[model samples]
Target: MSAQHPRPGITHDNRFFWEGLAQHKLLIQRCTSCHRLQHPPAPMCPGCHCFEMEAIEASGRGTVHSFVVAHHPPIPPFEYPNVIVLVELEEGTRLVSRLVGTPPDEVAIGMAVAVEFEQVADDFVLHRFRSAASR
Candidate 1:
C-alpha cells in the first residue's frame, strides 16, 4: 500500500463490489421483485421490501446528481479538496463516490461519468468515477 493511501474496510455485503473493481467492472444489486437497482448492496429490496435481490453488472455509465468539495481532511491518508459526488447511474441508482480526473469546480449536475478504480491495497479497491469522454 502507498504511504499516502489506506484501505477502506469491506463488509460481506460489499465484497462483490470490490471484486468488480479488480476486474474493472461496476456491479450493483437489483431487486428481482421490484426491478429496482440499488447501491451499497443491500440484503433486501428497498422498493418491494423483499429479500429477493441479485447482483448485477451495470453499464458503468452515470451522471453527477450532486457534489461537494471537501475542505477538511478526515485523516492523514485523506486529502483535502476531494470531490464527493452522488452519481445517478443510467440504471436509476445513485451511488456515493469520489470524482476523479477532474477539478472540483468542473463537476456539475448531469455531467457524464464512467467507473474507475483506485487500488488502495492488494485486496482493497475503491470505486471512483471520472468524466466520460465517450458516450
Candidate 2:
C-alpha cells in the first residue's frame, strides 16, 4: 500500500533523509570537520562551521526528551489525540515526531524509543518514534 499523507519538503540537505526512509533507513548528516552528527540536515556544520559533510545511516535509537498529547485537533491528514515528541537520538541530535505504540500518559522523559516510518504517500514517508515492543 502507498502512503496515506504526503508532505514532501525536498531540499538538498534533507532529500537524502527522505529518500532513505522510503528504503527503511534513517540517514543523518555528519560533519567531516568536528565529526558531529546533525538532524534536519544542513550543508554547514553548526559546530565548526565547516562545509565538509557526509550522510550516514543512524541506528534509529533515541529517547523521548519531551512530548505533547494532542487533545486538540491536528493539521490535515493527522488524526486527533496523537502524541508528538521531541526525540533525542543516541547520536545527540533531536528530532520532532509522533509517538506510537504507547499510551499518551505513559510517555516520559528518557523513555527508550525506536524509529517507525509510515508511508503517507506514494513517494513520501514520515518518521515517527515509538517505544520498543518489549516495553
Candidate 3:
C-alpha cells in the first residue's frame, strides 16, 4: 500500500546510517583513521581513503545553509512547491532534506533547524527538518 514507501538501498557501507534512523537516531560516518565526517556513507574515506569507519551520533541540529522552492515536476508521494533545504549540521556535514513547519518565504540562510522523523510506512521513516525556533 502507498507504493510501499520506497525502502532505501542499504549496503554494508551504509547500513549503520539506516539502522540508526530506525532507532530514531541520526548517525554520520567518521573515518576512524582520519577523523573526518562523511555523509551518504562512503565505503572509503575521502580524506585518507581509509576503509575503516565509525558511527557518530549527530546533534540532530543544523543551520539552513541553502534552500530551493521546488514548484515544478510534481511527483507522487510528495506535495508540490516543496521547501527543500541544504542544512549544515552542527557537526559540519551538510544534508538535503525537506523543511517543514515553516513557510517557504520565512526560511532564510543561517536559520536554525532541528531534525524530525516521519513514518511514511510501517517499516520506513524519513528525516525532515523544522525551524528550531519552532521547537
Candidate 4:
C-alpha cells in the first residue's frame, strides 16, 4: 500500500520502535532490571514491574507462532486474504505483524520467517515477515 494506508499513531513509548523500522532495524524493548525482552514497548517492565527500560536491536529472525488469513470485509490499502502472524522472535519476544511474499495456503505454524521493511509512504514504513528461506 501507499500513503493511503492508515498511519500508525506514534507516541513517546513507541517512537523508537517505529523509527528503528524505518531504518530497516527491528527494535525490542528490554527491561533493564530483569533483562526481559518485550514487544509493543511499554512504560514499565512486566517481569520486574520496573520503569527502567531500554531498546535493543532484534535479530529479525523468528518462527511463526500463529496466523490467520482474512478474506472477508476487505479493507482499503490492504490486500485481501492478508496473512497476519504472531512471530516468536529469536530474542525470546513475540511481535504481531503481517506476513508477506508467501501465499496463505503456504503459511504454517513454526515456519521460519525474517523481518522485511516496506516503505508505505514517504515518511512511513512498516515491518512485515516473510519466509526466511526466500531471503
Candidate 5:
C-alpha cells in the first residue's frame, strides 16, 4: 500500500466497519428490526426504517458483481489501470473496493474473491479483494 493513499473518514455510523478492517475482519451492518443487511453503513435501516442496527462478521467471501479499470487521468498515490470492483458478499450485501493481486484484464463478473486487509497507515487499514481460487 502506498503511504499517500487516501484514508477513509471514520464516522459514528461506520466506526465498527473501519475498526473491523483494522482487525482483519469483514463486518457488515444488519438491521436488528428487519434482519436485513446493508452496506455503506447508514444511521437507519433502509428496509424497515428502523434505527436499531448491529454489526455482523462476514465470511469474507464474495463474487465480482461489477468492475471497472481506471486508466485515464492518472491519480497520485494510486497505480494506473486500477481495478475497482463491486463485490457481492456471501452475506447478500455488496462492498465497493479494489481488486488486488490479479491482473486488471483477468477480472470478471462472477469471479470468486475473498477479503484481504492491508494496513495502509499506523491507525488505518483498508479492505481489498483477491481471487479466491488463488487461496
Candidate 6:
C-alpha cells in the first residue's frame, strides 16, 4: 500500500461487501422482504424499510447509465481525466465506480461494463468498471 493512498474505513454494515471483493466476487445487499438490491450496504431497505439483508453475488455485469470525465486536481492512485461512471446493474442496482479498459472519450451512456477489482492496500480493494467486451 502506498503511504499516501488512503484506505476505506469498513463498518459492520459494509464489511461483507469489502470481504467479498477479496475473494474476487462482487457482493451487494438484497432486501429479504422487498427483494430490492442495493449497494454500499445498508441495514435497512429504503424501498420497504426492511431490516434484513442478504449478501448476494452480483453477476458483475452492468451498463453505464451516466459518467463524467474528471481532469482537475490530480490525485494519487488515479489518472487525470478519469472516467467515472454510474453503472446500472442487470439486477437493477446502481453503483459509482471508475471506468477502465476503454478510452475516456469512448465512454458513453449505456456502454456495457463489468466489474474488476484493484487492490489499493493490503486489505482494501476498489471495484471498478471495464468495457465488458475488452476481455
lDDT of 4 by residue, 1-135 (tens): 342989788888899998998899999999989999988998988788999889999999999999999998888889979999999999898999999999999999999999999998888889999999898
lDDT of 3 at 93: 95
Q: Residue 18 lDDT in model 1?
A: 75
Tens-place lDDT digits, model 2, residues 7-103: 6678987888888999988888899888998888888999899999888888889999999898765566677679999999888888888998788
TM-score for each of the candidates: 0.85, 0.89, 0.94, 0.95, 0.95, 0.92
Cα lDDT tens digits for candidate 3, 47-77: 9999999999998999999999998787667
Q: Which residue pairs clash in candidate 6?
A: none
What candidate 6 gets wrong by more than 4 Å, as runs, is 1-3
Once superposed on the true structure, which residue ranges of model 1 sit more than 4 Å away at CA?
A: 1-9
Which residue window of length 10 is worst by lDDT in model 1? Answer: 1-10
RMSD of each: 2.4, 2.5, 1.3, 1.5, 1.6, 1.5
Better structure of 3 and 4 per TM-score: 4
Instruction: State how far residue 105 of model 3 sits from its true place (Å).
Output: 1.1
Encode model 6's per-residue lDDT on 50-119: one tens digit a residue. Answer: 9999989999999999999999887876787799999999988999989987888889899899999988
Question: Could you give candidate 5's per-residue lDDT for residues 12-84 as a string of tens digits?
Answer: 9999999999899999999999999999999999898999999999999999999999998888877778999
Report the lDDT of model 5 for residue 106: 90
Lowest summed lDDT over 10 consecutive residues: which window, candidate 2? 1-10
lDDT of each: 0.82, 0.84, 0.89, 0.92, 0.92, 0.88
Question: Is 1 or 3 the stronger prediction by lDDT?
Answer: 3
Candidate 1 lDDT by residue in tens digits, 1-135? 525566556887777877888887788888888888888887877788988777889887899999999887466566667889999999888999988878877788999999887787776677888999743
lDDT (0-100) at residue 49 of candidate 4? 100
lDDT of 4 at 28: 96
